[model samples]
Target: MSDTSKPWNSPMPEPQFDLMRRILSAPSPVGLEGAMTYGVLKPHFESFAPAEWKLQQFMGHAGVVLDTHPGRDDLFKVMIIGHADKIRMQVRSIGDDGKIWINTDAFLPNVLIGHEVTLFSEDPGAQGSYRRIDGGTVEALGAIHFSDPAQRSGEKGIKKEQIYLDLQIHGENKKQQVENLGVRPGDSIIFNRPIRHGFSPDTFYGAYLDNGLGCFVTAEVARLIAEAGGTEQVRVLFTIASYEEIGRFGSRVMAGEMRPDAIIAVDVNHDYVAAPGIGDRRMQPLEMGKGFTMSVGAIASEQLNRIIETTARVQDIPMQRDIVGPDTGTDGMAGVLAAVDCVATSIGFPIRNMHTISETGYTKDVLAAIHAITHTVQALDALPDPHREFRDNHPRLDQAGALEHQGSEKPETADK
Candidate 1:
């Protein structure tokens, strides 16, 4: 609805989509999510705000805080945080011969079989890159053919434990050879994939599109605000949190460490209007090239929710909502229950086949998401401070100061 006038045959903007590919190309499976946040996203934060940006990481988790306003010092802030972690695996053990064994919470195990993967380094502090150790695959159905169908476990179909990492290196001592290359029993493992275009070519395909676009939009919103000369007026604490795919652990750590006046979480949802077969629209809507969505669920921050809704309407950003849930099942929940009890809300793009390799979405939705987030910050700047009302009434609430924002701070130093 925004601008699909450019025919489907038209090529996407080279520079912008290339950057999205570079971002989605980085591996941040599960526990190593913070690595991608710092190593991949921090550069964009710096490129967008340079002197005003800062970063933080803890136990493989990372946060990129953009200090748009170096002039003012206040706990009154808004954080656009998204979980940067994707469900990935760890090298559990290896077979004496050349076969390998792995363990992980692959949400969709069937989708992983026969796909490529990477064997990353053991150093928890190391950033994940494509060059680490490539050309690994999960065992296939016919390759490891079972005699009987009943032998499979009903609890977790296509058990990842039984699935082996087929490095396919020819030799008697394959384990020893892989180990010599720094692949260890405990090294982090992730799906090794390059970002490719979907069938229409207007949409992008890859793993972690679930929140990859969310992380993209969060930082892009800050960049957009800065571009519109709205940064100083709208100070957002942008964080690329980790472990969000499995749990809200990264954001939990972030909330404990810093306090913001309001939190607007940017994330993704599997709300394609055209699903394979479905009765409920709440599950997903039939949308592809339209704008993004907003949640009208229990956890929405009243002030922030109304502001986003109004902004989308006034700006005429094409979108749909009513994908209601109790707490958004996102880091937005962390913002709702944080120590400061700040106002929290979420706006996200809808993606199809969410956790699988073929996850697809339109750039139009992505740009709309970026616009919505930036507009949220800009709109919040115009409205009353949602957190200020609570502060006036409850002076005894535990107050947290912003970490050393500018420079020369211990943990405040950019972890990149």
Candidate 2:
């Protein structure tokens, strides 16, 4: 619980907050992120980016990268990437009764029912142009009275195929009206919910916080770095990627092209402390207000983690160590996937109810991440030779010291 009586003072400026809202609200379904990346974020990046910084646009996807020192391979290249795309439902088919069937992507069927959504329909008449259809609510069977005994009881679960959207259409020619409006298969559908402040101070909830928050953080960090006169020894690439929800496809392509020396993948993490029934499983205790999360295992680079953590400690920024192993499960794997041989790590704020229409986050944590990453870049720039630092900082087994032990040299035969 957080204090609500105190007057709300935003951690970020009003313009930045407005940008966050616009970026999160923009329709950016997987593989169709041009509305978000190109339309919303690109202009914002151009507004404050220094004159020397170069904006890199991709050919295949709507990914954008802001390079602090373009074509400077001598300096250490650090890419901070956040995907601009979000998971969403796609129109699969239309029923004669005006119901639109959907293939729910990465969403629980129960969380979607009764929630309003906006469908971006591709017009059959005009290819490459889209139209927005609003005021539709996802539904299943309409009423509880129509449900079977299992559905009423806890014994049954809602299936994804059973869900459909209702536009309140009537009359005999229902499907015709829908088709005439250009609502067809493959159109993107997203929650029409907008980002709004939560009951507690410094908290906000909305749809698509999973990676919108990530992109917002990346943009803010870049702005902060630019405001501080930019980095000296490091050529930072502030990158916004696409298709992260489907796979790390877009990031892999970006990494392959840029071939940065290091990458910091910014994304959202689960607030396991606030998650329901999470105590039943072994999970890290993380929450919205606990501050930003930094990865500790897997492909997380020790040198980069050291720089970030040391900066946090010196700057008194609250941070939580997240144990991500085998794979970071974010775009941190993009470097490895692309065979770029770059050191990588992930930074995020713990979010509650991820992949839902009501994903929640704390502003303080977001600001903390911004400050921490900004300072870490500054620290990297201050180093005389960052490439050598990362390459040589790995622990050497030869320098190991033995701990005092009270172990009798094994009577191995007797133990066996």
Candidate 3:
């Protein structure tokens, strides 16, 4: 093996330790239930023209109450205010049995009565529940129903097909109560709770960490750049793409929209921590506690390689390079093809057992990525025109080729 101990072997210094410390301290773990909840609630929160009255009404009937805990009072308040501003409510009804019904007609259109649904609550105080409905889309004839918790335990883990919503309302005749409330079949059922966080002194986990980490890192970079009085010639689009896992939909749309001169896609690379298929040559050789990996391959741009290498040299940042054969299978591929003159690269962290409920990464890797990306942006701003340099440096390639051709003609005859 070649000596990997050059000056470049030194770990790059990252300044975002504090921010990453806080991030790792915060909880967000991804799972099937969380993903489903995100699909239901994401639209409500991300919509520009939010449905306010509808949301307030739903909260009113769902008996959504807000309470603050000691250390996280402000966090809870912000979350409440934010959720309230997004979801619109169509129906809020109370049942004789004291069950509550809250409906948002426009949020989900394909909902059917008796379809099993899982309910996630936004408030930490609310106990997340799962339920089933008796009738749906029948207009005044439908009743929201609840599943027995005992029965749920016996069944294999929550099945999406078997779940249904019990909009808590009871009537002697279900039709009469539904009619009074104006509930419809196609109305979306919002998962009640924000994805919760599980935190320890050493680990933080929650939903939406796939690209959420990217979002967090980019935002911090932007803040740092602004604070450092960097010039804003390069328009840095800190994109929080949606639907990436499904089909790279958000990145596809974003690449077209930005059409940037260059793109550096930051995504997680597999970390082989627990299991053993991954090897240093195949995936990232990066260790959990080591640092970030700067990949080189068909997807990486020559321009980007030059900048990153130069930056690493000047900054004394530790970086490792690996060959990504044909395609990186990252958003970088999309962005590179979209622009007239585009170069793409990826900075990755070692994430173990990706696409599972409990994907893991090191705090150190996250910090290293932040450092690498920030320096990369700075390097891009300072880089001289590479095309011009290439033309000047290699002016006589054609002449050299012809001379080599002439020399080759005399070499073939030699029996002597």
- Candidate with the greatest TM-score versus the true structure: 2
Kindly report the root-mean-square deviation of model 3 from the true structure over all alpha carbons. Answer: 15.3
lDDT of each residue in 27-94, candidate 3, tens digit only: 22211222322332333223321222121111111111111121221110111000111122223543
User: Could you report the Cα RMSD, in angstroms, for every candidate shown?
Assistant: 11.5, 6.4, 15.3
Model 2 collision count? 0
- Name the candidate that leads on lDDT: 2
Q: Give TM per candidate.
A: 0.81, 0.93, 0.50
Q: Model 2 off-target regions past 4 Å? A: 1-10, 403-416
Candidate 2: 10-residue stretch with minimal lDDT: 1-10
For residues 82-194, what per-residue lDDT tens digits would candidate 1 score against the true structure? 66777777777777666667775655567777888877776434544423677888773544365245545444366555667788867677778766666667677677666
Worst 10 residues of 1 by lDDT: 1-10
Regions of model 3 farther than 4 Å from truth:
1-204, 276-284, 336-340, 386-416
Screening candidate 1 with a backbone cut-off below 3 angstroms (N, C-alpha, C), the clashing residue pairs are: 272-285, 273-285, 273-286, 273-287, 274-286
lDDT of 1: 0.69
* Model 1 TM-score (2 dp): 0.81
- lDDT of each model, Cα atoms only? 0.69, 0.89, 0.44
Q: Which residue pairs in candidate 2 collide?
A: none
Q: Write the per-residue lDDT of candidate 2 for residues 119-160, one digit (tens) a residue.
A: 998778889888899999999768999988998895897999
